[model samples]
Target: MPNTTQNAPTNVEEIATSMQDTVLGIWADFVNHSPFLVMGALILLFTWGISALAARLMDASLRHSKMRGSLRELFVRLLSIGIWITGILLAAMVTFPGLTPARALSAMGIVSIAVGFAFKDIFENFFAGILLLWRFPFEKGDFIECEGISGQVEHISVRQTLIRQTSGELVIAPNSFLFLNPTKVLTNLPRRRITIITGIAYGENVTEAVRVIEHAVDECRTVHKDRPLEIFPQAFGASSIDIEVTWWADPTPVDVRRSRGEVVTAIKGALDEAGIEIPFPYRTLTFKHPLETVSLEKSEGEIS
Candidate 1:
């Protein structure tokens, strides 16, 4: 054993030689396996082409089936993404025979955790968006009120929903928040109620004022015949009596505010023409301790 060292290469030289052999062997194998590698690449390309075509066809079929326009787009995008991801995974496996799904998934775990933590809100919104697309609680062009914000749905995306309010303000709401809250879709029904309050001088024929309001409701152009219109005296107050008129109307074909404005205007005009007093606020002032002096001064001003 002591004499063997005298003719043997050093450890460093041996390591270098071993590395060279390994490199040469790897090169030889790669050169010999070129055809197989090329064939695998071709197969992967073919699979990708097929996947793309299949995804397109599926999307077309879904659209043709009369799915909600926004939902259809979302579904098609998700479908295409799934197909491409599948094709990519398959191609990666073909390129590397030892690339196991378990290993790949394990490698992604840490990165996925980081991504999830970094974009928690976005992920929530994305999932909520998917739910919205599938459930279709409302659609584009629908007038919706959510969390006290009322607007027409302008756009729906993977993260947020955009609405344009009647006041010309743009509201951007997170899909997650919208889904978690209560939403009222006004357009789901064909008609809505218009409630108006009018006042008449106190003790001046509450019954007659109510009749006038009823006449106004009946004659209003916006009133729906299918739903009954009503007018009744609500209360007697110090200055006036209040009459409430409630009517149903079709809100689909016209602007709600404008239609309501027209009805109110017509009712007020009708009342004015009929000489039924739509009273405003008035207060009677009286002096207690200084009544005599105030009366004398008021009489003096009137005389002047």
Candidate 2:
């Protein structure tokens, strides 16, 4: 038999000996790379120091510019990231002499593809947050409404937005949702136009009712006296005329609530004092044939 032992699987002793040789080879390689490793570490430390100093300098320069606060921060962060990335690539090449720029780029491209697939939503939110801070009108402390979520923006970050609801609950919303949907900025302007319906008895004077309602709203402390006030007889109701009352008020939630309350109170008091009736909601009933009068009365009672 010619070398039948060599053809067979290696014995335990032989396996152990081979493993020991491989370990020794790795150890030797590592020992040879010690100096390079130290140099790479030093380079990384220097890079960090440079990045910090550069950020401070950049921030100082940006303060004099009219840039938005969020946008200014973004520029500084991007500059730091670029510097750090360059430093890391240089360190990586110094540590491993065989890692050339082309090779490093290829490797990075492959790794980036894998990472992109693994963190699709994360990247989406990151880009969305960037767009929001860079170009969009959203800012910290602004009250915004998006997809039925109405709240004051507390903080905005790379992946999420912090919104404090009117009921004192904090909502951590993903930036992608806000970016992809329509967002209503309630406080974009100092004043907001709000509307309410006021009804008066059909027999009441329409012109006089309009004048009374206008005066009542104008007297409200929360109403913007300089802004136009509109009171129009909108429609005819069963027992009253529905008038649409629109006025401008402060755009804050607290102010909005208080202003509406004040206007409503003022209108009710003025109408009552002037002997103008705010009629109860009334409905008309008809039937193909005459029904029991008691049933009709009962149905009307339930409707009321």
Best by TM-score: 2
Q: Candidate 1 at 120: error in angstroms?
A: 1.5
* lDDT for each candidate structure: 0.80, 0.91
**Tens-digit per-residue lDDT, 132-184, candidate 1:** 87888888898888888988899988789998997899999999988999998
lDDT of 1 at 65: 86
Q: Which 10 consecutive residues of model 2 have the lowest summed lDDT? A: 4-13
Clashing pairs in 1: none
Write model 2 residue lDDT over 1-304, tens digit each, in one string.
Answer: 5796875556767888999999999999999999999999999999999999999999999999998888987888889989998999889999999999999888888998999999999999989888988985778889999999999999888789999999999999999999999999999999999899989998899899889989999989999988999999999877889999999999989889999999999999999988999998778889999885567888899999
**How many residue pairs clash (N, CA or C atoms closer than 3 angstroms) in each of the candidate models, in the order given?**
0, 0
Off by over 4 Å in 2: 1-13, 283-304
lDDT of 1: 0.80
**Angstrom error at residue 27, model 1:** 11
